[model samples]
Target: MTPALSPAEVTINVVGALFAIPIVFGIFIKAPKLVVFGFIGILFCFSDSTWGQLETDANIYSRGVGMFYFSLLNLILMVAGVAALLKRLANPQGPQLAPPMAKYLAAFVFLLLGHVVVGLMQGIELDVILGYSGIFNVLNMMVFMYLVIMAFESEKDTQRLLLMIIALATLRAIFGAVRFFLFDGDTANPYRNFEGLDIKIFYFDINDNFVASLGAFCAAWLLTTPGVKLGWFKRGLLIAFLVLEVAAVALSFRRTSLIGLGLMFLFLFLRLPGTRKFMFSIVAAGLLAAVASVFYEHRLQFASEDDMLSSLIYDIAPSRGIKDGRFYELYAAAQSMDGNWLFGRGTWGTFSGDRERLSYHGDDFSFVHSGFGHVLLKTGIVGLLLFCGLLAAYVGFYMRHRNSLAGYARLLGDAGFAGFLFWVPTLLVGTPIIEFRTMMMLGLVLAMPFIAVGIRNYQVRAYQYDPRYAVA
Candidate 1:
């Protein structure tokens, strides 16, 4: 028999159910668009391991309760997505439902589906193929992206969505700060030791740094982007939020967050005009010199017993040498693809070469620390190439249409593109593809440039018809 819930669990469940009432009602009322907005906003506020009032310390799929809640959310999102898509198709005057990158996305989806059949042919159980391989999460994200693209139609709608994400991310940052400093959780050692590596545990989940990085990038871009007018008080609030978000990321001690912030800075720098670039280059040179001096002063203290650059290269570039289990896992995964290099070992596949060094999630060895490695292991070269094509299409679409956007829409495109760049490094070294929360956020980010361009185009067409409506 199953165990009964305690009073605390009961209260948690009650509050969760009450909170979900609006979403359920919105769906029932055939307002899937509104529900999609709410769902995405809620996703920004929580993490993958967060379900109802309980937060697990590991992957949510490993726990029965976590999986139940995860599956429930997935079902709701799928239903809402279908309703929203149908609603769009039923309206003759609705904005264009297909994004410019539709063909690339469609091809990628087909590849994923084809691999599903391959997994079945390889005798992998259906549940294992879907759950362990993370195929369901990836497909669900694609559906959510479609819902976002369909639901948000106007510049105001997209702007509101961005503000909602920023606001929720700020709240999460505040919550994480309080939990780390004021709550009873570990302050000195805030990370959970996972397979010899330290994964930071804060607030409700391990991916707080990623959330903080996103908010920081968005806030920073909005504040710095030229022609974005705001009152002093509003600017002050935004600046404060940016500071808090950056602090949260720094406190979390995640290198991925720091790298993401650095990449955003580079993107912003490259976006500057020639005059500003020349002026900023001098200051940047001085900053680089100062940083180099500090590194030189501490040259002998690095773990690699070498200079700063060598230490960094040794840590990040697995091709340099395999010093730890993390890099070894990648090497082992590569070796596992020897026989099935063309189509891969399918989902639920395992790399037995490094079984002793790698940690298994439950009884399955399908999970990998690297997203690209995971894709290469499960779907092979074809899948990886298709995945790259999808990413390239997204970047190309942004570049092609960015100039048509103005004001807040332009900011959205620029920030969204920078955010996607921020995720590229994580995709290579981290398992973001398998994480539900990460995939949700990724889908939202990936849809943003399309959203910005779509609304801008709509305004252009409106202005052409009636001069009264100004193109924003």
Candidate 2:
């Protein structure tokens, strides 16, 4: 694995990558208008920030200046790319209207707009924040997904993306494993607790676990693509790598991630026709996974995790806030919205310091992070319509195009869709109300399906009028 880059290198990357993205987007060079407008929309995500958590010494300008350069530009390039896409779509050729894909895109757009409306009700000004964030991260994810399709143009592109994903994931596993090896001794160690662990390994420290996050997600997605492409020796290497990754994630004990991974495989099976075989494979895989988990549990001497099945099964509370507070959060947010529920409380409330925790002991209001709760809080009833419709639409699209969609479409529509569908797990473990990194990841994965649709839209128009190119 490549050694982690130094801070200087990271800075160099942020600079080089930030500037090059626009050119890489190719909208200005080839398809200017679509690229330009799309970029303009994406800029909101990069707006400067004034506050954050866990700063040893806080500086308002730090947040502002940091994003001003990076996120701001990120927004610009993304919009430009989108514009380029629109320009390309002005004419292209292919089977574009797979019903499922159409529904996913349209519905998400609705949810996005609806979320902005929800914020308006509470009188918070997050329309811009959520707007920009939704546009950039979500859309960019799809770009990569479509790129998967584009890779079909060249086998090399396909290998590059897939390899990059694996390499990055492996790198993350290395970091996480080392961190665990260092910190594994403490079971209930506060330093090892989720709060501290987040600060210690990735987010708050010099070595943030940013790669670890993507690593886990990517590794989990790869689990869905299990197969035999290697000889026995190489197969042994693959087993070691999988074990390395699984160990890395297990080391973190990011339970939601586990949930995310578990559901992902489930979706892979259900979405595919080979449900029975998949189940058996998972069962076998589960045994291996179980043995690994046992080794780690013994290694750390950590207490076993609460029984998720039982709590979910019996509808019991495992922890005060952890158990069933999500249900109430969902309920309260909806109830407060009343008629406004249709369009939403407004986007601002979603990000605003609006929703306080029910705990009277000086607890603060925060996002429930349940996809459903977040929808109601951000968009109200109508937003729910869009959100629910969006999920249904994508799942439907997978049903229609799983086989027909080629190359990246297959990867993005199938695996990417499966990744987004894991939001169900997010509801229970409930991420931080403050927009955890994973939300952006989820948004990005969800966004890819739309990208495919948009690409196909252009492909069709480009070739639609060609008499000789009619669908054979």
Candidate 3:
């Protein structure tokens, strides 16, 4: 196990924070939105601190406080959000809310706060679950989402944000790939005793795979989009980046991420017209994968017979004797929501303690290892429906305006769609929404519709009709 934090490490952290404070302020001076982007990038690429403390529920008050205080990214966001809010207050004409967006946002906030109230009534400690805890973190997300929508005012702004995402993904992929080959002692078999690895390795293993896979899909989607005009060198660079991202995900040896990558590719391929050709290609790829699995089985620690297919089947299909696995977890979650199945036990409410009882290592009930289960456990059926409705609203909005959306905005929408779809299969055995990376992704997805609209039509019209509009 890793030792306690050394004094040197503490000094390094404090020094880093001191330097970041000025950098963050400077960014605010130029454009406040960049701070939000920086925060999202850090969340996506830097997961070590958060991963170390993911299972520490709100019940653990000391750890919870440490998690928030030590999380430099979250602290930056908190400061930036307050600054942006104050600026908005001083300048009332800063960013007007769109009616359509206001409706959805209202529903989401109402449900979130309503759940908190209900949870409080049920005797969940206010101090434990409220204020900077995982449960209250959605309030921060709402602020970030509002800033994203307000900042993304033009096609260029949208493109820049997508480029930032790609850049973050590229950095993670390069780091993961380099670490796998040169840094990791167990290059040949990295997953061996992986659970006991240090925070950095464990962090890179899970979160890096997500961004790598999702970024690859998004880059591929952009390359395929009609209006995207990538020169030969740029196209080559993107293709190389995609390959690196895919390689990183593959080498992580995380089956869920691998499944997600496969599903993303399948989803992208389905958009094309050549179904028969796609099917043949998939079969050929499967055969090649199986052969490669056998050839590299000893060196790569490939245990399953038919490569990943067998492993996927084994995971989905029930065992002969044991009535456990993801299926059992889902069942238990449903059964546990007996009386409070309507409003739920509230955010971060652990009414059933299913996670503690079912955890392989006695992890507390912070996460059920299932996105749907986590939502169901916290918000019940009603909250679950509202959450899904929020996602569905984004999907529906994207589909409606996909044709008219600017090229970069369309690509972002597509990426968000792919990311959401990738979560479907993984959700069975993964808790995505509660995780900051996926939560940030969800926020970005929710912001897509507004970003796609370019500056509000009224703003455009006002500028066209009156020179004073531009002066203002």
lDDT of 2 at 382: 66
lDDT of each: 0.66, 0.45, 0.59
Q: Rank the candidates by lDDT, best first.
A: 1, 3, 2
> After TM-score superposition, what is the CA distance of residue 95 in candidate 3 from its true location, in Å?
6.7
Q: Cα RMSD for candidate 1?
A: 5.1
Extract clashing residue pairs from model 3.
none
- Which ten residues in a row are the worst by lDDT in model 1? 58-67
Model 3 accuracy (lDDT, Cα) = 0.59
C-alpha lDDT (0 to 100) for residue 240 of candidate 2: 69
Candidate 1 lDDT over 296-320, as tens digits, reads 3433134366765555455555564
Which clashing pairs does model 1 show?
none
Off by over 4 Å in 1: 1-30, 49-70, 184-207, 275-314, 317-325, 359-364
Cα lDDT tens digits, model 2, 1-472, are 1234567856875686567666656645463434433332232112121122322232211221233432434454454546545644875674343334445455555666555555566565553546432332333433433332332322233334445545655655565556556754323233335333332322221111223333344444444444413467755555567666555444434445555555655565554446445554665378437734643453222433544343332322445443254455555655566566566555444332223545421243435546566656655666566556756766665565455554444554554565564555664445422332334445445544554444444445546878475322
Runs in model 3 with CA error above 4 Å? Answer: 1-30, 49-64, 67-72, 82-101, 111-123, 131-134, 185-190, 194-205, 270-308, 318-322, 351-363, 455-472
After superposition, the stretches of candidate 2 with alpha carbons farther than 4 Å from their true spots are 1-70, 89-156, 183-228, 267-326, 350-366, 404-414, 427-440, 443-472
Q: Write the per-residue lDDT of candidate 3 for residues 186-235, one digit (tens) a residue.
A: 22233344344332232233556678877888777755655568899989
